[model samples]
Target: MEFGTTSRTSGKPGPRRERSPGGSDYAVLSRQVQEAGLLRRRPVRGVVLLVVTAAMLAGSWWLFVAVGDSWWQLAVALPMAFAFTQCGFRGHEAGHRQTFHSKRLNNAAGLVFGNLFVGLGFGWWMNKHNRHHAHPNQVGRDPDIESGALVFDGDDAPGRTGAGAFVTRHQAGLFFPMLLLEGWNLHVASVRALRSRHTGAPAPAAVEALLLLVHAAAYFGALALVLSPLKALVFVLVQQGLFGLYLGASFAPNHKGMEMLSRDERLDFLRSQVLTSRNVRGGPATDFLLGGLNHQIEHHLFPSMPTSALPRAKPLVRAHCGDLGLPYTETGLIDSYRQALGHLHAAGAPLRAGG
Candidate 1:
């Protein structure tokens, strides 16, 4: 698969990852990032983001109502779906505590953006995402890499039979198509998590449940009111399908093709973040579309950094990685997808070959 300019650490292994005596190398880089003021919180950006999202939601709803029971409501669903994913991105930032200084405020923002806006559980996503960040690409520890519907690790690719084998063998071809259902899957997972007594929801289960119910009511109730049953059904399919596809596509490029660390693979914090994640090269449009996730390496290293600040932090992080002789992967958007899909195809090769 094609990639942009990468260091010695890209296709080839770089220096061995041994912790330096006295302290971790991450400390040195962390100090530089912090001193550059990249760690500072900027609430104005958060406020502006919230306002714009709210306006988009409001405008879309108005258009839905204005259309007044027509096939065109499906058109309205397009922007609405995009708006929902934007809300999801904001909730993700809140979960990382990147939007606010106070933990309570961040949690509150997460609830509003997640359960209230996107109908996803903030707590459930936070729990899942935090694990991913802590152990990105780790086969067992990172939930993102754990095999289920799709087998990510080669170790889990063999011995499949029947449907599982067929799916595993064709997973690369099916990946993007499968993402069309991811929106529904996320909703189901959230509801299931909220129902369990041991749900890791940060808010009271009652509160989370209530907000989800409200969102569902408002969302479907409005759709039902404005469109015929068939039209509403079509609209829901279009909106949710596009939502899932958009969200999945935005996230898939970050680390899918990168190295998957085994439990025994030891890496310092800096290396772990840089080595596993990838960056996407583009202009401001890329930043907006990915919600600043295109800068995956910088975001993973300094998750608390504001999204707007990721561009500013990129050069510093890249320079430091260069100094440390670490791999810093950056690719065009299309090429990133190619790398990820190529990895999936390669992982599934054994199944295709009669294993």
Candidate 2:
């Protein structure tokens, strides 16, 4: 048999054509984000979360008042713990454009959430977090995690060493105390934020400084007038500590060590996001507590989409990935945490702030 021209349809390249701007494929799965439930969009609906948070804050305030005795104030601020956590949640939703459709409302909530408590910085977090969504596993870019400092093999980020490493190695003892002083982990990025352009604007920075100052002055001023200093300290401790744990866990589990992109790690941004990010599957508890963050793939793809609608979109993502044969990792909440721990253990060095 003699070989002749093969059929083009049989795995042959088609005729080439001119490409359009950005050279991106026209097909896209993106949907314009909608508020969780429209028609209820307003200051009133915004309170849906604050309603829960308010009750908790009020109860904590009342309890702190009722018990001005020995160690009891420390024992009873549990409701306030929820309030602080919700404070983070409301701000997180604002960042995602899921809390309320109104940019002003969300920004206000985020600003308060940022500076409302002891250690939060809304401006810094919004920058890093939004970048994380854009870059996912891009090694040089994703600050959602500090992959530590030293790089091992191709993927491992071996951590800091020497005295700092020694401290990180023995970090457990310091966890509670550091958590206490820092106002949860809210202040974690504020210092770095100060030197950057984002923090350069005198207006926002002054606002940030004032918020921190007022945050301090108000609590201390309130303490001097009414409660004992020791009791006020305790209030800060419990709320900050619990909220810190929530903050760390909420973020770390999403993409601790899936696959990191290098400075040279070349990938299409959209593809990399799908490759590195995973879902927590879903459940009622995940929905309420996580504000539907468990829908990681859907969240990354359609970030502006209200978190509640992620469920509606999950299958669409899974289907697309299924077609592409790309890895789309998912696990339960506990399992994801376990995976983060595993990533840490494999790194086996001390954690650095930007690792």
Candidate 3:
């Protein structure tokens, strides 16, 4: 481990747990939590995500609007902010599909939110995310967990010769811009994938292209017609930049590095959920900014469960972990963010050709 990082084995005094809910105990664990009578109900979570999304939209609009004619820059900025949240919210449920009982309804909602904010939609994401979850530490196949794929290797094999060595060391910082302009990155990736004839390019790539153009036109043209150019651009910057940064950061923290255990090591969903992730407890700010993504372990275990209920539900996870002797790691927000940055920085360590 790097400086300021400690292994679960070395930390504390008691025996720590690593495994999650097993087959036979699954029912017992659920029964324990359910019997507590504190389990968060479903639709309540859906309603809450929607409510927060609405409040963000409303607050941004009302605040800038209150400023009157002097501040058109904000006009474009605020709605895009909301749009970003809407995108995240959609994916949140799609990942778990716990928000709605109907898979079709969840997928439809995910597609609308994702495309509106330039995401890959539920179907496309599932392909990537599912593989990632299944083989999280595999160097090439795990698209979900970013296990140093962009980072360079110090000790290279004969095949990774020449410039590939230098490229690895510099990838971390270089990747920041891509994270910032992820919407563009997503489009570009889609283009390349389509051109290379990758499976599931959403049929004929041209439709995707046209879809992109139409989305751009609708957002820009509407802003131009209704608001001014200045506000429209600011809106894009705020929502596009901050929203991307936050969402991407949330992802980065979840699985940057805990253990490079193989998919086989992850014998079950619960084990994968706990070993592959950690969380932050940022108090009230967590609810506002992250939608309580601070509870990633709990979220992964009960993916179908809604976000609003995560904080409340996390205790159950902690209790279960305690019983199982799991090393439930919890760091403050700043520390957690620092850990993610360190992961990126470490991944970019430079190396020479092995061959």
Quick one: ranking by TM-score, best first?
1, 2, 3
lDDT of each: 0.86, 0.59, 0.56
Candidate 2 residues 29-113, lDDT tens each?
4422232332233455556666676566667767766776557656665666656666777777777666776777777777776
Write one digit per residue (lDDT tens) for candidate 3, span 66-119. 654445555546465545665565566655675677776666555555554454
Ten residues in a row with the worst lDDT in model 3?
A: 8-17
TM-score of 3: 0.73
TM-scores for all candidates?
0.94, 0.76, 0.73
Q: Against the hidden true structure, what lDDT does model 1 obtain?
A: 0.86
Best by lDDT: 1
Q: How high is the lDDT of residue 20 in model 2?
A: 28
Clashing pairs in model 3? Answer: 16-325, 17-325, 17-326, 73-231, 76-235, 77-235, 152-168, 169-348, 169-349
Ten-residue stretch with the least lDDT total in model 1? 1-10
